[model samples]
Target chain A: MAVPRELRQISDAVWELPVSWKPGMRVPARLYGTRDLVEHFDDGVFEQAANVATLPGIQKYSFCMPDGHWGYGFPIGGVAAFDPDEGVISPGGIGFDINCGMRLVATNLTCGEVEPHLHRLVDRLFERIPSGVGSTGFVKLDEDEFLDVVEQGSRWCLRNGYALPEDLELTEEQGCMEGADAAKVSHKAVQRGHNQIGTLGSGNHYLEVQVARKENIFNPGLARAFGITMPDQVVVMYHCGSRGFGHQVATDYLHVLLDVMERVYGIRIIDKELACAPFRSPQGQDYFSAMKCAVNMSFANRQVILHRVREVFSDVFGKSPDDLGIRQVYDVTHNTAKLEEHVIDGRRRRVLIHRKGSTRAFGPGMEGIPERYKPFGQPVIIGGSMETGSYLLAGVESGDQTFYSTAHGSGRVMSRHSARKKYQGKKLVREMQFRGIYVRTASLRGLAEEAGGAYKDIDAVARASELAGISTPVAKLTPIGNIKG
Target chain B: MPYTYLEEIAIADVAFEARADTREALFVEAGDALMNVMVEDLKSVRPLVRRSFHAQAEDLERLLFEYLQQFIFFKDAEQLLLRVSKVAITQETGVLGLTAEAAGEKIDPSRHDLNADVKAVTLHRFRVRNEPAGLIATVVLDI
Candidate 1:
């Protein structure tokens, strides 16, 4: 359990734990963090990342983002890509929450314009957005409609009059990932997702109205192009994913992969938590297909949520959504697997990339980027803990160091139990109010667990990613009103 | 003996540390604690069948993780609450060989106040060590 001494410091922001530090490791482990942040990592995270480096066909380095935390198999902020032919895919790499991600929307209305009705706006949003554990939304679909959601993703919302075409243009993969096979998903997973669409499941998921401040605007041109104006323009952001269905898919396949890893692949793992099968193997393929279904389901889930938000805004402002200019800035998934082409040791190769608690920060002009955002790099929405300031970043060329990936959110610094014990929910709410932030949630305990103090300093984490050349800061967004599930 | 809820993440862990003169008795006590965490009453349900598991691992820590993970898997997937009937472990060189028998019953949610859903057992702060008193195992789960 000792810290590896062989790590070579690449820079103040980067450290390299070489492959030679451990036997069987195929690649080095590259960690992105300041000295203080790196020191705070639980030693087991380094051990896990070293183990991930040993996986076949790992590219560049098994990279850990600054917000790294100990997780099953891979560290929470771990990023790894494997060659399609030689690499292996592990369900642990994607974690249990498939396609969990964040989305940011821009608004034409400025903070001054909405200040008079801020409380009413927040209240309406809270009521319209179903939240909390096991909460169900208004979207009730039959099996056939659900299948379309699994296959079409956000497109399903557009067809149902829940989203605009422009929103689809701003979403990654146009809000639907390809290769989803509903048949691959279990009936249990489908049942779990039936009433959960558009519902924000509890634990770290939230909807926030943010005020863009003058001091934090790093790219005025880009912000202006995205229709963000004035020092106090208000924008809404939320983080969520496919609910119970995603969890069930992950649970079912973790067992499937565990059995297959022993019987068919003959692979021995250091921890059962790291259970995996070859990407091309039948078991791996099946999980990937099912995972895609969950991804699409989440896309549709967010789309429906967007529709609900739009409805609330229209009702409050006495203006249509188009007039309010509540357009999606971008949506990106932080969890899930994708087949992507990356330059590996000088050659372009196709690999199945697993980004657990990492977000894709593809630079401007990347082919996979939706055409509308081709001029602007993919919008990276980094959700902070309920008490802190969330960030809007853009992928830059410097991200080539880590395959254009960055931290997903303000990572947990304390366990939920510890947070609840340390801070009373009522006191935390009052403190947020004093800071000009409004809060609402179904469970006070849930709110306490998600308090900003329970997480690492998001500003520092986002800055580390920017300093390390993985992502560039575009704007700093401070919350004025918030709702949690 | 009642199992103490030690800690939980998305992944949860309940443990009972006990001592006995024999290893079999210690394992039985551990099983009793595990079953207590899984459900409310141990005496209410009758064991319909006894299942045996034999596994070999390169290391003892991993062997312990696999053992607990297997119990969780069975409990969640099959609605079967397992009680360790017996256990035997042998160490030869660096490898450990284990044999165990477990009994299970259908799940009754009313009896089982499930605290948290454990996603996976993690190596974070994981430990399995020997003391003069007895064997000790501790783990941090990924909830």
Candidate 2:
């Protein structure tokens, strides 16, 4: 597909689409990427971004990051903010996997030490971590108890001995978002999620063991602050979300909002997935409260996974997690809409920013990050395909341009069906294993669809973010072992 | 099977168009497309257990959306890998209702060649259209 004809190039790293491109667009749409990246973007991405610009009360410009791709209502890696009183909340902006995010953990082990035990560790983690389709977590909760899990989030994990006190501090929103009312969540949501706390869902979700090579460390001081001290320090990173629970929450609200959006609020949407309700209206508030429940559920899910990861490390090395220096670096969400204060036209105003496939990269001295690392800004984890390396970045001061939002991952450039036809899963696994990366997966066909070549260059995306000043590179982590579901 | 995957529609998700001479057959093919998306081989999912359910909406588009969403719900909430074995659609004035009987067993990843977890059936250009000789529907499933 060719790039849209009317896209205006603002800079080598930024492009703008005027409101005149679409009838209902209330603001101009901006895209952050290199010319090559933006040019290769699917036409659907542009349509989705333009459609988002039409939402009522949308402030400034609607934006899509370098990793942006086609999505339901907004392009993946979309970022937009709206006035809390006048704007709206749409489940489309948050995505089906509510609070889908990345969590990184640091360990004192080195690559050489882990190399010999790599296969065993991967197998054990695969067995212990519940992966693949329809996999259930070890955590069991009845409907009544499940409500508490959604309400308390990682705090529930802490009480259940799955997390430490410091883990909460290192987490975005301190692991438990406020005003999450379980009562607002549906029974179906609880049933789908109650037993899925720690299970990694299938389709691009993965758990990997990575090494931080010295040559890849761009900012040693900030890297050390995020726990990359040794020359080839080993770390664990996993990507997942609230499981069936979050999907159900998003599904329920999308239908509910769609039923009343036009009849009640008179809000028209270009896409059915973009159905929304006014922020202050009863439907919107209910959705917000319910959305937080999914957010909290996902936070708790990752915390339990972190605990399982620590246990796996401890069991492999025959030492306690604390003895092995296993600690959480940071856990941050990508799919969420949260109320935040940002300066607009020289005045600080509170707005609800809906970041679909984008990360919150709060710069130095920002209020949301942990105080211990506030001087260096929040740690941003950018996960690449298992075949490629991932990066650890920091929020930059200039990120105020997009309200401190940055790309989430190396976005897809090819369709899964096409990728599957181009590469066989078994062959891809063999190739990756030969290159020093051990692999474990639930399905070979699923793995084939995730070949590194299917996505854009991660280096280019990171470089674009830096040039755009939305983020700053800190360190790069090379994968050694991977477990996918 | 009277369904084909639309690779170009939803790059990050899965989209398919199902067609049949009748609405019931169209619904069946649509569910098959959804089931096939989750499991690579539809035959890999044995009809060892049967489930009966109902989905009602005011329109055919919403009806299709509600009907296909049930597969995601079954997999997530009940861990069932089902295929629509029987379906009945009824129109009562402005309201439309669908009752379906599906069969499959609890998903065993080892036995089923799992492809991707279909997160939800999205409404991105979702539709059911009527033609002179048949009906056609387009559906997208978020993976």
Candidate 3:
């Protein structure tokens, strides 16, 4: 497909593809990217974004963050909100990873303090947090217990001694989502999730220890307010999602919606990847319920992982997590559909917001934010590729342009197979080592696939997003050591 | 013929890549390798019913993704062990294509050694490239 000639440049970092450019589109498509990045888009991304624009009740614009790329129904970094009454909910929009997201934990430990024990710390994390595919953690739960996780999320972790109440205060949505009905989830999904809590499921899921790089700190005042002191202060960041439970829920619902799309809804899709059912339909409700369960399950998973990390640190350093000043900076879900109130058509209305490969960057004073951080705005945790620098950002008022959403990560630039064909794990490891970054993976193949060169430049993407006012940079974190699943 | 497995970071280095000759064969081969990475032999179920499907994508890559997603859907939702039998593709345009196919069985716990469920086929590093020997595609599935 040729680049649509009607795409008008709104600014240095934004472009608008008018709804008239594509048939069936209900709204325009807004893309946040540099001139170079906009030109790099392939036909699939444009089509996917356009497809999103055509959805029944999408509002304002189908927005894509700087890291946008081709995805099933919506491009990665896509954000759209729909009227609860008229809009349709597509499982493809939330993605199978469910609440695949990132969490940042601030620590009092400086880089100098952790550098000496970086190897030991990573090894301990690798041991405590089971990684790789099919890796199970020590946590075990029965059906009812798992239901508690589904319904209560991080609160379940707190009750189970996996987390503290304070952690919940710092987590987005308070570490749980409402409307979770475990009964809606299949037995298989529950079974799959029972043993997987605290485990890092493979493929892009990882834990990293990072230090703030000097130059990328644009807001020193905000950083100081957030307790980010020295440039070498060490922090822990990890990204994962609801394990098998989320996969099963998405799988189960895709088929249900497929049947609904054909039999009851009378909707014909151009792509099965766009499988959906009317929001008011039985199948849609069931999926929404089950998906919430998966979302909560992810919160529980991350909570348990946090507990284990604390344990590892305590055991190794002979200090409690609190004594070490380890506390959750923030936890944010990237893939999810949630009910939110936004101004639509000059009036505030409740809508269902689906953000896939995107994060909610609610500005300060939003009622949904936790009290402690309400004045500062929501913390946005952006995970870059292993070799790139990740960032900690704060939501800004300017995000109203994008329904308060931002890109989730440094989007991929190359396919994994291509990376494997072009590079060797050993050689890549050596190169990372030369850059002063240490990486440990379950397989050499996994390491090569996550090579830094395989992803877009994180600095560029972060800058573009910040410049667009979707998210404001708070701190810049450069990885020193990491473990990948 | 047994399909070979190759891992690549194809699109933008965001996803994993797996390839096979036949559509069903590719799915089964990819399934085996993907499950193997997570656990062990998960496709040991006996061939049951042959289910036919017709999936359309804006392009071949999306078609292949829907193809793999269908197998995952069957395996997770219907508890069916689906092994692709045939795959036919007609490319209508640069990013549009139609795929038709048939798959093998119902999943039997006694026979099928189920492993990690694949969440979705991501476009992170997704690609489908034609080679002199055969057609090759790479996908990064969120498992």
Question: Which candidate has the top score in DockQ?
Answer: 2
lDDT (Cα, tens digit) per residue for candidate 3, span A348-425? 988889999999999998988878777888889999989887988889888888889998998887766676677787
Q: Write the per-residue lDDT of candidate 2 for residues A1-485, one digit (tens) a residue.
A: 67888999987798999999999999999999999888888887799999999999999999999999989888899999999999999999989999999999999999999999999999999998988788898888777888998999999999989999999999999999999999898888887778888899988899999999999999999998999999999999999998899999999999899999999999989988899999999999999999999999999999999989988999999999999899999998999999999999999999999999999999999998999989999999999988888989999999999999999999999899899899998999899999999999988888988889988899999999998899999998989999999
Number of the candidate with higher DockQ, 1 or 3: 3
- Cα miss at A475, model 1 (Å)? 0.4
Q: lDDT values of the candidates? A: 0.78, 0.91, 0.77
Residue B123: error of model 2 in Å? 0.1
Clashing pairs in 2: none
Q: Model 2, range B31-140, lDDT digits (tens) per residue?
A: 99999988888988999999987989988888888888888888888899999978999989889989999999999877888888888888888888898858999888
What's the ranking of the predictions by DockQ, best on top?
2, 3, 1
The sequence of per-residue lDDT tens digits that candidate 1 reaches over residues A72-163 is 78888999998877777887899777888898988888888987888899898888888764456798787667888998899889989998
Candidate 3: interface RMSD equals 6.6
Better of 2 and 3 by TM-score: 2
